[model samples]
Target: MALIEYRFDNLRHDRIGSRGIDLQSLDRRSMEQAIAELRALASQKDITFPRLPEAPVEPIIARAAADRKDFSDLLVIGIGGSSLGARALLSSCTPGNPGCRVHVLENVDAHEFERIWSGLDPERTCVNVISKSGGTVETMANFLTVRQRLLDRFGVQGVRDRVRVTTDPESGILRAFAQEEGLVTLDVPPGVGGRFSVLSAVGLYPLAMAGLDVEALLAGAAAARDAALAPEAESNPAICFAAHQVALHDAGTRGLVFMPYATRLFDTALWFVQLWAESLGKVRRHADGHTENVGPTPIAALGANDQHSQLQLFMEGPADKCVLLLDVEERRDLRVPAVPAVLAGLQHLEGQSLDDIRAAELRGVRAALTEAGRPNATLSLKDTGARSMGALLMFLQCATGLAGSLLGVSSYDQPGVELAKRFAHGLLGHSDHAHLRAAADRAGQGKALTSVH
Candidate 1:
């Protein structure tokens, strides 16, 4: 059986007619063009993550095994794309190791910094600092601080044993340090951007080190890539999905709701929020240099839980949102024994399991949203296992790439984020950015008073 499935049946486009996107019309208009764009991206050797699952990962696997034997705690340092995908996979698929806990420091904020360190015994923990260019400020800052602690406790040998660097193959500062210090290292692959690097060493090495089935995850992602690459517009889920959603965006749908029924899949939605927001939210276009505010806002919600919270506003507030629901089928279903009901009218739920209630609620919400004229779709996962999670991640990633193609935007580059990085680097005393430092100093003078209230 296929490990995952994608369907638009709940979209009710036939009944909604013009309000919901007509896929046939979308196919007639832009299917070939979108496929070509996606194919062009796939052909680029620099962007190899689409095929990363099938690539050699033995080096990552071997090092992970070695690290597993040596350390009782693991810490990963990075920000944004560098850490989100890895964090999501670790939380979703890996059971907590009673002996070794994993911590990902994606923030340098004081509270976040203290919280991560407070839980760890510095002597036994291993730190994997990841950044593609080896120049990311937050990552390097965390690495330097943690590196001194490891050196103080275990000396230079401990620093070499406990620290691993994942970065560019030959050129980056991290790679240079690894060569000089005899530290184990993994390449982040040449063209893979941070947001698109989950399948690369950025994610796989940490997963392997934590004793998860990374091979199975990659196999699942490979299967999804093959499915997404299918040439036919109607048959290829990724292309078809992008066409539909982009059409909705054209029709003024500004918000995207990702509501998952399973607790384990919550991080998956959070990961997508970054992927979609950073990839598609853009100012420039490949078509005639068109510049206008564009892109869909991704909103995350959990089923049964968020139904009581965000659904009210989502259903009744505006006509400008679309909802994607994730329904997970568990491999092992627990049954509830017949028991006395707590309330007089609630006897009907006495013997039904919690999963059954969640499933029923999914159906109810879908029906309600459909009747309210809200455009909605559902992604059903076979199980909450690694393969299923892997397939889901790949499906959305391909869809993001395809959507960028349709919009004529460069999905891989994040220009807005880079400007902020430059400003922060200047403020942090980069010699090449004196002007930036002066402007930041000016900007900070009046900003402090804003915080007083």
Candidate 2:
């Protein structure tokens, strides 16, 4: 069996509840009705259910990887979905491998700009300035700052050659600027939101630069898409997984803790948190027009590290939390150590090798979590490669969408973010709302704002 199938089989046997739900119990007529409703809801508005790209993105990624593009580092400038997904992919594929670093500048902190500038060599660095709209203040501000820095370090000629753009084709200012300057460009497809653009070229370029196998990644994603679309409940892993999570939430577990064993996946957890929180968070109105809060609270934790910190709260605090553990079958390329003479007489300790100790530790953690009845699920990646990471990304996206549907919320829209954006713009003197600006000025006046409480 392929590695993907084996890992999935292990998940099925070890994680899924054997008898909690059966499709047959719903009656064929009722099952059809539920599916029809789900399909209709998924298709409504600009929401497009996940689908495999008609032309594979692998070859394109491979070409990018093989190109003679000489750049020391690729500076990705964007916020939220524009930057998070690509950062997750790059971090996972090369956990500790030291190559050209993929530095993502998502925030407008001046200190971050100073740090990036300190490390970057303008002559060798390539900048990928990404924004769906030409008008995101944070992104545009960062772009201008970085461009000026590059021009100062090198001449105008160098700035023009090193800067690239990824944005909407015809409408955005960035797109127009790239065209005028003759800089290389990637098109961000219209109608696809930033959160949903990971599988698109937005993520492909960075993954290629990180030396991941893009083809294998796409294949795994394609397999996952197929499974999500399957009719059979047993064959469809995404549907089964989503149904279980929904059942758990309805039964009173509304908080989700994403715990990944490897430190590199910490950023991936953040991305998932945004996807789940933003997508499902909404004020839903009933037949009588009554509204209610209907989204899960998401938290991210790194394993081994969090095993010391937050595990206590999770284990004893409330029974209303569900944990998802992302465990890898093997780390990229670390070898087992040889036995030493630190301990003399423990039965297995004297002769056991390092691999034995590592394996034992992994087994102990899984067994302990399972015994605690924490309602935990594990995603086992065969190895941290391009394909495995790609498959994982697609799997989580589909699972989250299904979970949202089960909870009766739209998983693609994020209307709550607008309020914060409006507030921030007013604070920055970009909005016409005078009251908001006045409030922001008063809030910024206090010494407490600069000090840690």
Candidate 3:
């Protein structure tokens, strides 16, 4: 099988003639150092992401198989890393799986909260609440809301029967609650953080239970991890991807433009946005004792669609964007049948397929961007199937890991997010954050707006 191909032809200054980096001759010692750092992180006793591609699938399968009889719908409850990967997967792949739809509750917005609450029957729905820390405020809020729905319908006994949790193995409030209630619990490995936990039970259990091929997905990721580990810098796509992104960032490119040519892969871009933004966007630098803020903003756009809306700005607005184009060889296609002789003006579309048209549009934009001297790269997939999707995810994950290493930032931790969580809890009357709430009240007391009524 042809693995996804990443070509940097459009990213070279020789091709763009000015805006790009000469990654071909640049010293790779730094790249090697970054990889070494990544290896060091993997070697540390506390991390699990490096070995995630090879994570066992049997346990996940068994859990899914066992839960299939009682739950028709899988309701994933969590925010950010907890739900993004699973959402992306089910969004992109579940159309082909002969299984019940997966509903994800990632926010506390009234509409979203009530929509999911109303759709699921507590008796038939399996609620998988995933939170690595088990105390993420938004996740906990959703879990409580959903738990009550179950309680109201099936009472305490049925609530335990339909509920499961994927969280820290030994600690956290969720852990304590699960153990106390005798809920089926799956461990969210200590080493694997939420964003990187897809290969673990956090993602696998729901997918496998939904009747999708978890092994094939893992196999694809394993292949990608192996490919990324290739010692040769030029041949390792992960290394190259990291290098290009770093070089561009250092060269003053402020935005990472991910515009895929396919519509189905849009959520993949959203998933990448979270992975890229949350992981690489950092302040503390381990390499040099760090800058307070540094990270490329990730922008998502869909081809043929965004071409009309965002292409103008990208082409003429600023030279601070690096475009990454992606397109898959269409797995299925529909022909534009010959038009009636009475409608002769539309003959140009006759006999042409939508896939053919889309592919051409994809090529056209790549050429247009090149001609515009826009630094870019293209990730071409042979097909938009699980294997290639798995490879793409793993490739990007490896790239993100190395890119953070190069930037000297902590890729796995989100120290800044903790402040907001604390402030939010304080506002909500949580005793632990009471002091923060007091501080917030003091801070906001004098800031009320004065306006003419």
Give all TM-scores, in the order shown: 0.93, 0.83, 0.93
lDDT of 3 by residue, 1-453 (tens): 366889888899988977888966655888888777766765676647777766666777888888886678889888887877877677666434566567888888879888777887766788899987777878888899888878887898998888889999898888998999999998888888888887788888777767777777777887888777777787888989988998898888989999888888888889889899989888854456545677888999999899999999888889999989987875565889879889968889888888889988888988988999988898988776667777788888889998887777878888878898899888998888888977888877876689888
Global lDDT of each candidate: 0.82, 0.68, 0.82
Candidate no. 2 TM-score: 0.83
Tens-place lDDT digits, model 1, residues 1-453: 467666676455675555577665675447767777666667777657687887788988888887788788889999888888878887778543333467899877878888999999887788999988888888899889988888888999989888988999878888888899899888888878888899999988878777778888888898888888777888888887787788899888888899998887888889999999999998754457657767889999999899999999888998888899888776445666665656677677776878998899998998888888788888888876678778889889999988887776777888878877888989888887757987777876764454455
Judged by whole-model lDDT over C-alpha atoms, candidate 3 comes out at 0.82
After superposition, which runs of candidate 2 have C-alpha atoms over 4 Å from their true positions? 1-49, 55-68, 94-100, 180-182, 331-363, 433-435, 439-453
Task: Give candidate 3 regions above 4 Å deviation.
Answer: 42-47, 94-97, 284-292, 340-346, 438-453
lDDT of 2: 0.68
Worst 10-residue lDDT window for candidate 1 reads 93-102
Rank candidates by lDDT, best first: 3, 1, 2
Provide the lowest-lDDT 10-residue window in model 2: 4-13
lDDT tens digits by residue: candidate 2, 245-307: 666665567777888777778989999988878877777767787887887788998777777
Task: Output the TM-score of candidate 3.
Answer: 0.93
Candidate 1: give the clashing pairs: none
